[model samples]
Target: MRRSRDVPLLVERARAGDPRAVARLITLVESGDDLLPQVAAALAPYAGQAQVVGLTGSPGVGKSTTTNELVRALRSRGHRVGVLAIDPSSPFTGGAILGDRVRMQDHATDPGVYIRSMSSRGHLGGLSAATPQAVRVLEGAGCDVVLVETVGVGQAEVEVASLADTTLVLLAPGMGDAIQAVKAGILEIADVFVVNKADRDGADATVRDIQGNIALSERGPGEWRPQVVRTVAARGEGIDDLAAALDKHRGWLVEHDELRRRREARAAAEVEAIALGALRARIGSLRDGTELPALAARVAGGSLDPYAAAAELLAQLGA
Candidate 1:
């Protein structure tokens, strides 16, 4: 229920690094508030200012732990960081089932860091529907880097590839994730393969398995190859190697001009989603009007073919 007039002030405060303003703006985005369009417009100028990195993997792979360490690593280099942890929602109450803040207490008192956990609310693709807009909010809040941590759902989480400038797919030893990576099509989306928990038994075997798969894949000349980094995130071991891998990938993205291409594609997808949602809303409104019912009646009576009736309905809706 945010007012449209307040959007400008919110955006101004967010640009000045006000955490509460950033939180309020993200809440509006998540709730689909009536003034969301105004909020988006106010924040549009700051789009693409932050480096968005997505971390996703199956449950128990230590995504949150890795993210916590990664934030510390990034902050060490003086980067203002924002984290959006998408947690699975409770089936009954529709609230976040896991609280990420409990695990990332080190940065709770840091003014340069902002962390917010969003419930997936049964949304598919391991992310909340408002994730892209929420990223925009973080960018507008002057964060140099934004981390998007998925809900850790298997297979369906590949959608993160479309949103992230660089996508990190985490796997651990003894989980058979190296084999699952192929079956789940994770090999195609991973820019960096972080074999976390490197201290575990069979860790080398898992790394070898992923390297073997990477060797078998075909790539065009100058295409970026995924880098594999091992880490024991629980003890903050090998985090520097992980950070180096991320920086290397970022350099490649810039050198190849892939960053602009990826951002353009992300913007195109966001625009299309908004357009489709508006169309669906308009069609829903027509459900209570005469056009849809008349069309349905004609089709049910077999007096008009469904294709033609649909065309007429679209025409009536000025679509």
Candidate 2:
């Protein structure tokens, strides 16, 4: 645990581009340290400063490769970038299973970029529960862009839309992703669709599938339509087009004033999660006390109904 007094200094160092300080702050966020309140307080002022882009797709869709090329493209335009790659957790160790981040080794020595692979730790939404706080840490450290790459858990990955200002759904030929997108409700969440591995066979068909789906969806006047860009990520092909699409979407977000609304919703969800966690902790504490057990006994013995017993428990905790 870090001393609460050190939080301000750490935040200051991070803002000055001290990678070690930034790393420490993210570690604190991931671990849910006792001083997290102080860290969040210190970082609150920098909220919503970075362009948070989330990249998600199936496991074999070249998400990492696309992210790497996108990072390079963004850096070419001189943007300070941060990447949070959420990898599946090792069941035994509860650590990031793909911690090496082999595809992103090209930027390891680039001080202009910060990359961190976080364990999803059994989190169901393809993201770690701590991701939002970690993103705040990166924003406080002066990153102009933060790319959140999800664990690619398919159907449950729509949660990324809540955290990102722009969500890119990557697809590859023969992956059936175009069809799966409809069934998984991904069509509603995607801001841009990237048909990666565009040099492969069936690439054109995949693009057409997505385009056809987009045409079928109804939209209100002036609503932003999703764009599709094809890319051969391995060869660094069409990356500029993808970047252009992202910038265009960002401009639209600003023009339509959707960015502020999205950030406000993100903040509200974070607060609600924290409040629910505190409530759960209070309930857990009552297990060691008499309130919960007494309530359980009454409910089990038919002396009190379950809903009334729950109400009594909440009342006892002053909830």
RMSD in Å for all candidates: 2.1, 2.1
What C-alpha lDDT, on a 0 to 100 scale, does residue 220 get in candidate 2? 81
lDDT by residue (153-233, candidate 2, tens digit) is 654467788889999988899987456644547778999999999999999899998999889998888888999999999
lDDT of 2: 0.87
Query: Which candidate has the top score in TM-score?
Result: 2
Candidate 2 lands at a TM-score of: 0.94
TM-score of each: 0.94, 0.94
By how many angstroms RMSD does model 1 differ from the true structure?
A: 2.1
lDDT of each: 0.86, 0.87
